[model samples]
Target: MASYLAQEVQLARRHDEILSQRSVLLQQMETHLGDKKTEKTLQMLAADAAYKRNTALLNDIEAAEKRLQAGVHLQPHPNIVKIETLYWASVEESIPKWEQFLLGRAQTPVGFKKKKSSEYNISHAKVAAQR
Candidate 1:
């Protein structure tokens, strides 16, 4: 988790650098405002995209921090001792279930109560039981 947080911090720094460059480009484009409206528009659009990308990175960092906090609260001093072939192979399949569990959806043994359906009033207990 410390490594993950460090990587995210590095990524945020990179995004900040890119955002700085975008700001500079926007400023240069502002100087040419009277000439070539199309070019100025394109530059603005590019800056906007960069801003959106940075915003997304901020959101990802926030989510990662939240997950880290939740994990620490739930499992202190967690360690990975070994990984068998079967468990390693099924990691891709299990990740989504674990994500759902983290997001408050019920899981086998760990979470017994099923979440209520948001779109429809119908109870999906039968469907969940099948899983």
Candidate 2:
């Protein structure tokens, strides 16, 4: 019984480690994805898909650990977390800054254009002639 308990404890510790790693990766993905609507951000998200894969692996480990502890003889169902999709959405949100940085400038869509008027309008004589 003590050996079984020890195994359970080990499994739980392993699960905890995986969960921690998964959490950190998700956080990183969130940071990269937030407000980063740019091509580079998309690429970063694509790379981050690996994190999702890792998360799934961790989920599998967790399920196995649970089964081991419960002495269950059935296969556990797969995890249904949508980590990749969530990360992708985050990356979409991060686009604005990425785009601004990539474009090297910010654009004002509704601001007024400056009018280029002469300081004295031809010293006022030109206006008087027109009048």
Candidate 3:
């Protein structure tokens, strides 16, 4: 409850900060436009947009807080969960394909064979020494 209130306060402060910054920007825009009528129109539009965005965010937070306070446990839909699980599982299954696409080559499989140190010949040793 306290956390929600703190979050709400923080959000309000941020919204006000954004509006203050935008007000300065709008003043600069008004100077650039040089038409009182157009400047007023633009200012109104900007303010309306900002108000909508801020109100929407505040409403969402308020709703969430209210729901939390109500203490009503809600269960997720099984179908939705099942679908998401399958989707993620498919994504996990296709990771190798994604790696191949991104890398422009096949990914080395697990437990790939490697030459034993004993398999290195004198020529190989000489090449390594040259490097």
Candidate 4:
């Protein structure tokens, strides 16, 4: 929320600066086409790059404002609440450690030792190991 507000303020500052520059360019455009030595004035007046950049910035600002209005940052995530609730419920029910694995409360199992089965070692695999 605070981050978006800060960006909004920054964009407004840039908007004002661009408007000031646009005014200057427009004024130059008014007197420039007939003048042979005013290439810079013509270039400045004709370039739409700045306007396009500002248009993109305006889009971002509008999106941020919409998110702000929706109060997205203040809302609790439904998934997070559900996951925490499940965890706490499991704890409260005194679920057995082994059963907790079936309930999705378990951490990853420790590494396993290699077995007589040779599926992982192709060179050692035999006829019975073949699918």
For residues 1-131, could you state the per-residue lDDT of candidate 1 as single tens digits?
Answer: 99999999999999999999999999888877756787788899999999999999999999999999998877333244234545776876677768776778756535455555763344465567778
* Residue 101 alpha-carbon offset, candidate 2, angstroms: 75
Q: Return the TM-score for each candidate structure.
A: 0.32, 0.28, 0.28, 0.29
Which stretches in model 1 have alpha-carbon errors above 4 Å?
A: 1-35, 76-131
> Per-residue lDDT of 20-100 in model 2, one digit per residue for the tens?
999999999988777466767788888799889899999999999998988766545444236666778888887764677
lDDT on C-alpha atoms for all candidate structures: 0.78, 0.77, 0.86, 0.77
Best to worst by TM-score, what's the order? 1, 4, 3, 2
Q: What is the C-alpha RMSD of each candidate to the true structure, in Å?
A: 33.1, 34.9, 29.1, 26.7
Better of 1 and 4 by lDDT: 1
Question: Which structure is stronger by lDDT: 1 or 3?
Answer: 3
In model 2, what lDDT does residue 71 have? 77
For TM-score, the strongest prediction is 1
The model with the greater TM-score, 1 or 3, is 1
- Per-residue accuracy of model 4 over 42-111 as CA lDDT, tens digit each: 7776677778888999999999999898896685799999999999998766545446566788763344
Worst 10 residues of 4 by lDDT: 108-117
Candidate 3: Cα lDDT at 110 = 57
Task: Identify the superior model by lDDT, candidate 1 or candidate 2.
Answer: 1
Q: Which of the numbered candidates is closest to the native, going by highest lDDT?
A: 3
Tally clashes: model 4: 0
